[model samples]
Target: MIIVTGATGALNGFTVEHLLQRIAPSDIGVSVRNPDRAQHLADQGVRVRQGSYDDPDALRHSFADAEQVLLVSSSDVTADVITQHRTAIDAAVEAGAQRILYTSALGTSFNSPYPPLAIHAATEQHLAESGVSWTALRNGFYGDLGDLLGPWQATGTIAKPADGPFSWIDRRDAGEAAAAILTNASSLDGPVNLTLPSPVTLTDFATHAAELSGHPVERIAVEDEEWIAGEVANGVPEAAARFTLTMFQATRSGHFAHPDPTLSRLLGRPPRTISDQLREQMVRTE
Candidate 1:
């Protein structure tokens, strides 16, 4: 059986559908934090296992008789995710699962300064030490950028704590890559740097959205200290948020950057452009 965690999320949801397209429904297992909310997937013929990442024993029980386990990483910063992910890894090992597929961010290395990247890097190391055959899908910035930016940008302005170029890929496309790896049982033995072929700044995206939506855009220069202070004032709790914007500033300083067509190559298509993703946002929000 093929097992997938975080089954209700966009990445996991899309992966589940893609897996069905590539294999029989009976071959799929989906792990949800709550089984009650999994009716849609259960109706689609996925065997839904009720378990959260915190319950490693239950996670192991779920992994029982599973051949491949797709462990989707959590985006939480409480270090709770660290505990959860380690538990799942240990459970998979105990269950003797043949292989593991991990979802991680792009460009993670041993020396990453970004807190999220650092945690994922440590998780990658932990997985590597477990001795199971594994595939690490190092994904890029997701196309959800516009959702994060649009409301603020559309209010007579566009702004980011960011000041440099960034490449982004659609979440669905990344999901397609993950599904491809599992169904074909292909080992992309990676740190696969998944991303769009081109990078652009939030400033550039604002300018383009201005042209498309006819809303003139403006950049509000909040210094790293000021911006972070504002976020704290505005109730940004995770230390990751401050660290995230710092990475953006680092982008201006020429760190935390890569522009590879590895993801496009995997899917035999080009990654979504900023404009393409913006249009998608327009459709989604409307």
Candidate 2:
């Protein structure tokens, strides 16, 4: 059996859905914090167990009878993320999982200006010393591009701190690729970059948005501190604004610029491009 953690999240939720299509429902189980929330999956014959990274005993029960376990990266800024991941890793190994898979970012470096990348680097190090075979899916940046693009349609301008190219990928594609890797687990080990074949800068995205909306969108670079203040003024918390500023710092440092063909090879087709993602977002709003 293959057990997946955080099946309630967008990324892992998609992974479980794809896994069901590829394997028997009896072969899949999900370890989520709230089993009631995943009752829908339970109805489909998937074993849903209550598991939290903070609770070692619960995680052990949830991860029981697992050949492979997918450990979804934690997103809680308030919690000790590395400790949480360590707990999960130890639990999975204690539960007798043969191999472990992790969702990691594309440019995960300890020296990265972005703090999250450093956290991922720390977790990867823990995985290596855990005495079990592991695979880290180095997924490209996946989230709402609207936050980066700003209110382009209303303002006719994409304004923010300067940024470099990013090989942005859709979450759906990343999830499907993860399922493919899990089913064919023996072929890949260590870090594997899962990203689109090309990279796009903020200016490039602005151009695509302009063409798709049939409106001219100008790209403007603002000072980092000024941008943070503007976001704070607009009701975004100062700490959150500063965190976003660090992402631009990482981007300009070329942390997210690399693109690889490995994702295409895994999917047997090219993954969705930034333009394709933007077009779909536009359609949803219309």
Candidate 3:
């Protein structure tokens, strides 16, 4: 049996849906913290088990009789992130999983200023020592430029720190690529960077938004502190604003500029672009 963690959330939920289309539901299992949220999956004949990174025994039982396991990184952003991953890794080993797949972030490193990337880096290191064959899907940055460009909606001006291009892959593409990897578990091993083949800068995003909005939108470079203050003034929590600032700082340092084609190779098509993602979001909101 193949087990998937976090099957209730967006990324892993899409992964599970794609897996269901390609494989038999009886051959699949889901380990979720809240079974109520995933009753629909169980109703479809999948083995839904209650599991959590915080509870080791529950996690072990969740992976029982599994040959492969997909460990979606915890959505929690606190310092407990590393510990949570470690707990899951240990449980997977105890459950005798032959192969493990992890959802990791691109640009993750031990020294990364971004908390999530650093946590992913540490998790990758722990997985390396697990002795069970494993793969880390280093997914690209997600989120529309519209999120960062919210201020631009009213002012028609996009302002942010000068930064390099980011290979921003959509969450849907990332999920599909993950399902493909998990299905062909033995075909590849080690860390694979799942990113778009091209990177786009903030200026490119502004141009696309202008076309969609039918208005002129100008890009303006501002000091990082000023940008953070503006975001806070616009109702973003102060801590969240600071975290976004770190992402931009990392981007300006070329952390997210790399474009890898592994995701395209796996999906057999080019991944979605920033413009396409933004357009889809606009339609959804409308």
Candidate number with greatest TM-score: 2
- Residue range 1-286, candidate 1, lDDT tens digits: 8999888888988899889898988899987888887789889888988766788878887777789999999855565777778888889889889888899887676565455677788889888888988878888777456434746445756545756666667888888888888877457774777777877777767777777677787756567777677667877865745766756765675444678777888788886677887876767777
Model 3, 91-151: lDDT tens digits are 9999999988899988888777676888888899999999999899899887555676665
C-alpha lDDT score of every prediction, in listed order? 0.77, 0.92, 0.87
User: Candidate 2: which pairs clash?
Assistant: none
Q: What TM-score, over all chains together, does every model reach?
A: 0.89, 0.98, 0.95
lDDT of 2 at 137: 95
What TM-score number comes out for model 1? 0.89
Looking at model 3, residue 108 earns an lDDT score of: 87
CA RMSD (A), model 1? 2.4
Give candidate 3's error at residue 95 in angstroms.
Answer: 0.2
Query: Global lDDT for candidate 2?
Result: 0.92
After superposing candidate 3 on the true structure, give the runs of residues whose Cα lies further than 4 Å from its correct spot: none
User: Candidate 1 or 3, higher lDDT?
Assistant: 3
